[model samples]
Target: MSGFFKNAFLIAKKDLYSELRTRQVLGTMIIFSGLVILVFSFAFDPAQNTTKAVIPGVIWVIIVFSGILGLNRSFISEQRNDTMQALLISPMDPSSIYFGKLLANFTMILIVELVSVPFLFLLFDFHSIGSVGYFLLVLFLGSFGFISIGTFLAALAANSKSSEMLLPLLLFPVTSPILIGAVQATKIILSNIEKLPDAVAWMQLIGAYDVIFFVLCLILVEYVMEV
Candidate 1:
């Protein structure tokens, strides 16, 4: 167990270091997220009556799309540099690679969210959340599930000729439950119309999704990489 985590951390550190040197994945995600937020801000009128109604959907949609950009690149570097096979043949548990990649992807997307969220609040005229704690929990659960599944699909599609295109087609459908849960949970947090229990219900849904899929991905990634 210790070896599993140590190997995973090393793989994650390697990815993070590579990203820091090249700025490929993180840069694209941040820029894409910023532009999308700016465009939405301009397109939607903050003073409009429907602003709050649409804000949740817009925020989650932007997150999903921007995250796709990073997820698409998650395995591309390994393929591009011909290191996928080496990683696969390594003595470390294959789950380590998956968890490592998941960590890297999660970190990149989290950073993108942290940067763009304040801009989203400022532009959407969002003032406060009903429960800051619940809001963070929703964000964490939603992002972890999304990236876990995405990292799995990315490895599955890494060998494809049109992986860039194939990844989204494979990913979007599988991630619908996450999107639905996240958007609804976020809506509840932002609106605060419903009680804390209401948000808790959605949080439970997202948490279950995260745990189930994260475990499934960990168990199955070895077979995925083998083929």
Candidate 2:
């Protein structure tokens, strides 16, 4: 158990350090998210009261796209210097590598979401932080589902001729459920609709999706890496 954790931590730390040094992945994500927000602000008239109606969709769209950007680059650092091949050849269990990469990607997604949420509120002038806790919980759960499938897909597509294009094609459809659940939950929370049952159902769906994908990705990652 200790050995597993040790290896995972080491792998995660290496990725973290590389990200800190280059800031390539995160910088692009933040800039892209900001630009999306800016475009929406001008493209739609904020004074016309359409902002609230569109804010939820806009926020989720930015998150989903930005997530794809981050996930696409998740394996770039490793592949750039041929480190991924070395890791695959190592004695450590492949599951550890998958988990470690997933953890790092999860952290990046969460950070991007965190930074973008405030920008979203500011851009659309959403005053009431109604159900902020629920919003964050939904984000975390949704992101977990995304990262699980994304990590596996990223690994599988990393060496492809057009990995950048292939990943979103494969990942977007598989992860759509989580995105739908998240968007619905956000809509309910933002509108302050008092129906607890609907929100609960959405949350349950997100949780189930997270669990299923996490296990599925774990099992498939080893096979993908082997191939």
> What TM-score against the true fold does each predicted structure earn?
0.96, 0.95
After superposition, candidate 2 runs with Cα above 4 Å error: none
What is the Cα root-mean-square deviation between model 2 and the actual structure?
1.4
Best by TM-score: 1
Task: For each of the candidates, give the backbone clash count.
Answer: 0, 0
The Cα local distance difference test for each model comes to 0.87, 0.83
Give per-model CA RMSD: 1.2, 1.4
Candidate 2, residues 88-178, lDDT tens digits: the string is 8898778888888888888888888889889877877777756778878877888888888898898888879899999999998998899
Q: Candidate 2: deviation at residue 1, Å?
A: 2.8
Residue-level error in angstroms, candidate 1, position 222: 0.8
> Model 2's lDDT to the true fold?
0.83
Cα lDDT of model 1 overall?
0.87
What range of 10 consecutive residues in model 1 has the weakest lDDT sum? 192-201
